[model samples]
Target: MAGEEFEYEYLYKALAKYANEHQYPLAQQAYEGAGAAEKIHAAILKEAANVKTYEGTTVYVCPICGYVMAGDSIPERCPVCGGPERQYEKF
Candidate 1:
């Protein structure tokens, strides 16, 4: 889970870079958390800043079920539904 979050940070940085390169104010603005979008915006901002802390990192969600995968990588099997790693999705 930790590694995945780290990876997502990389994704975020890439997104931010793209947003900056294209001068997409909405994307840039989307990086800033506000109201209902606060959590997502914060994640994007963390990526932009190259944040390394998962203290506030959001957990991965399993598309197969409502299970939340926190910590690092997806488990070998879902404790809730016995789904494989492929069942998990980034938040």
Candidate 2:
């Protein structure tokens, strides 16, 4: 059972790599064998569950360059891409 789980983990990594490399068919195959989109969704949800949500501090990421910002108000400019406050996403 442990070995099977390890194999699935390996498949997950391979699938992610294939996806990054734009081999969608290979990635889809691996992802399906590893339990498909639900598995990925569950993993994301599980990781998100562990995060400590802050009510006071607003966490934002810049859309242009994925620059992260934490504050009550948007920054004047994104540190990574020089994007304006409107380009930031709040979480």
Pick the TM-score winner.
2
Quantify all predictions' global Cα lDDT against the true fold: 0.55, 0.59
Task: Supply the TM-score for candidate 2.
Answer: 0.39
Q: Estimate the overall C-alpha local distance difference test score of candidate 2.
A: 0.59
* Regions of candidate 1 where Cα sits further than 4 Å from its true position: 1-58
Tens digit per residue, CA lDDT, model 1, 31-89: 42122133343455556568566575557765654456555655787654566877677
The C-alpha TM-scores of every prediction are 0.35, 0.39
lDDT of 2 at 35: 43
After superposition, the stretches of candidate 2 with alpha carbons farther than 4 Å from their true spots are 1-52
Provide the lDDT at 87 for model 2.
Answer: 71
lDDT: worst 10-residue window of model 1? 32-41
For candidate 2, the 10 contiguous residues with the lowest summed lDDT are 32-41
